[model samples]
Target: MERSLSFRSVSILSPESANGRNVVALGVADAFARHGSTTIFRPSAASKDPFTRILLDAAESAIPLDDSIGVSPEVFRSHEMSMRADIVARYHHIIDARTLDSTVIVGTDKSPITDPEEFSLNAKIAADLQSPVFLAVCTLHRNPDELLATVHACEEAVDEAGSKVLGLFVTGCSPERREDTLNGLHELPYQVWTVPPQTVDPQSEDSIRQSLESFRQQVPADELIQASEEDWNIPVTPLQFQYSLLHQAKAHHKTIVLPEGEEDRIIQAADFLLARDIVDLIIVGERESILERGDALGLTQLHKASFQSPHDEELLAQMTTELCRLRSKKGMPEEQARKTLQDASYFGTMLVVLGKADGLVSGSINSTANTVRPALQAIKTKPGSSLVSGAFLMCFDTHVALFADCAINPNPNAQCLAEIAIQSAQTAQSFGIEPRIGMLSYSTLGSGKGPDVELVEEATKLLREQAPELQVVGPIQFDAAWSPQVAASKAQGDPVAGRVNVFVFPDLSAGNIAYKAVQRSSGALAVGPVLQGLNKPVNDLSRGAMVQDIINTVALTAAQAD
Candidate 1:
């Protein structure tokens, strides 16, 4: 597996806080650097905060600027003068006025500027430099009115000056207070970072350091840079099924469909996959028109993909025939069916159905309804499956687990739940994982009784009867499913308790939240909502999904088909 570190460079500007400046700043800088970032510290003298003073001292000690530059100043009049001079000089060198792009600026001072004119002047300079400023403010000590006014002043300046305010980082407040602060700042349109009370320790520099480090790691620097290079690229990795599909598509050298053919991101992804022999792409559009557009955009490599329109009679006819046969039992008129199946997407889906291609990749131009409706109606489900469910191969390097129904079937019944579990198990087995299914619920076994528990219990019993060969346990909470100690304490004799590879959730809401929680909390690489039980592999993509998303879906579909 290829591994690449995702990095984000950020500027830390903070005021004096309970934790001394040196400890907070140095600790945070150290943490961010450990996670792969070049941190630039900017100390503002407008507020004489101890945290800020300590940070300046720490930075000066850690990174000696005057010594490197050979600047000799006898006995500075004030700590502020020496610190300000060092920081300003360092800033000029690190973040030069010329050639600065895509840097995150973290501002610590929340003091409402008494001099609006001077504040506006500084704001203009900051904006002209093109930085995404993240304002860090304390909610505990500062008045809500003053905090809001200060953020508004900075943001207004940025907006007027044509700069970006990425978000507001609120620290030193209780959870309830944080929520109130966030609500108050609702008009700001910036992401709010409410530091947990536990994560914020006025006395302990380690706690604050850990908090800042956590924030820095979530910046998605690589994804942002990739997006800057290619307009539509989304940062994602291919898991087992998807990787298998990509390799197979490359082996066979067949054309895969890209409905959103014109997007620079999708085109870039297609070009990358093609250049690496990962897949042969067939972009859905007119050849000359797309090429002309690509040329105008200076994307010369986009010309490599094969192009086709939905109006192609042969393709439309083949799609119509396939859909009609699939829907033969529905008693639909041939003319209506033919007319309905003539869409570019339907034609592309039919290609997958007929084995003309290994897989179909789409969803850029169309909604999930438009992209997946035709496939559901035309391709139909596998022989025994009554409905479709999705599973995500949540991976942490070599360790991968399946999180099911995160995208499809909002609320499933007992039978649907059973099918999802069995299918997820099968999907896991296909990916070389021995299937140990855990039917997830808020309650473990029958300890906490409720309708939901009963539902999960019934589903587990149904799975046993439906697929006796499958090793499954039901009404297990997430902790018991993943932790051996918890499993031993709570679910003593359950075989699949701690070693579950496939996790079947009660519904979409549970599955979606659970998967994201685990992924963010544990740093798991989630790879699906892999639609299961289709006669062939057909899955839906999120509207905001990028080229890497399409590639991964294509690979998973192909792997299942194989």
Candidate 2:
């Protein structure tokens, strides 16, 4: 929530025991919308927030509604401080994404809030947003004097937290007590809005608009502050990462060729991508057969997908020529090239190389070798890359880490290891992960000496030589690399020790095992084996991959495409 004084904004929350705060919050949000471009930001367990949904429906620029709503309340319970920072960052992201002219900062209305310090949480979030606060108190179905005490107590809470209270509204009061309540609040120093119960029919737009107009006129314009920039860096949540990945793929509008259209998973993924309009999809299979299969599966969305037959005479001829020319140095004769193009993987890769499509997704029914070999032969590796590598986006609830060399390498030598590290870092960067690498070992800072450990140390040195700006820690145990307490005891005073987001394992056995262990044990969403270091984007899905897996790989592949 950076400086945007041009946009009117305020933070509204119930003080401890207030009722009907959501009503006031909604009114305020509606009022702000009258002025110009307006957004609503609610920070809490936002997975299923009704109020946020309403606001989202009204906002012009739509993202996932939960995108503006922060983490689950239970998540915020343990990760209060870090999650608060994340909430602040989400606010900033929404503002940037919406390019807001106005915003309404709101809180959840439901009870059973898990965070014991609920008021404090909202207070700090408001402080971070650098917006003034409005504490609304409800005097419905209760004694006015007792509610006044709650209001008085809340004054100190917001004030002690240094939140400037712009208004203290006595909202939701019934008509019978309205006059007495207003007279009773005459002694109060802060601005007050004694809003009686709204009487208009729920479906009347004119009444709603009039109420909103009244609320807008009431907000003190002179006190409104534009959001200003702050130096806030927080990890994006898993939900956020997935949404962002799909959103980017949709925005770039890249066409991805899916080679295993015969596989049920791939066909379903084609439907999934097409249903969302995420990308223009091409499913490589015999057109008639794929249509028959799609019909059998009740996947009408697949109607939008273009089906390409690898056996198409003209396409095969072009691919044969291109492949022979690209692989001529390796002695790929015309006969071999023609035979290769018959394979769907090779045909799909050729489509990308020929610019018929932007990227390729294969391997649902093929081996990784079958999938990657065609790309390696025709598309080749980018500059500074001598070998290809694979990275998984280990998406934890509140952050994403890139697990490297997990699929491609078996037991790379020091130089190959370093190259994997470099490629992994660059891949992570492209995917929005700032690479803080942890080169894993059984030893930490020479606690044990072995050839394996020596190889890791040499790889670290080589990685630093190749990419000096990366934050890397090597010859470190996994625990030390992840846990600050463990790092202090094992490898003290190293900046990158405890905060590693990119884990480069010593070998495939370790890398594969580690990612799987964390994924299954902790319930993290592991997306990829994102094939890295290729000149063009081509990803291989596991044979056991689900339909969703195909969709994810296609989306990632599209994002990687130019």
The candidate maximizing TM-score is: 2
- On lDDT, the leading prediction is 2
User: What TM-score fits each model?
Assistant: 0.54, 0.71
Q: State each candidate's clash count.
A: 11, 9
lDDT of 2 by residue, 85-179 (tens): 56765776777555577777876445665555677667666765655677878777557677778777776666644455667767776657878
lDDT of 2: 0.76
C-alpha RMSD of each candidate structure in angstroms: 16.4, 8.9
lDDT to native, each model = 0.61, 0.76
In the predicted model 2, the residue pairs found to clash are: 2-227, 2-228, 3-227, 3-228, 3-229, 4-226, 4-227, 5-226, 45-73
- Candidate 1's residue-wise lDDT over 1-562, tens digit each? 1212333333333332323222223444444444443334343333334443444343332333322221222111134323333433344445333332223333433344333343443333333233344445556676677778867766676555444455555656565686677777788754555554334453566765675565455334343233223221111222323444455555556556666666666676676676666666677767787777777766656666777776778877776676777888897666977777556677777777777665566666666677667778867788988887878888653356898988778999999999899889888887767889999998998789989899999999999999999888878998898888999998999888998878999999999998889888976656666778877666666666666666666656656665
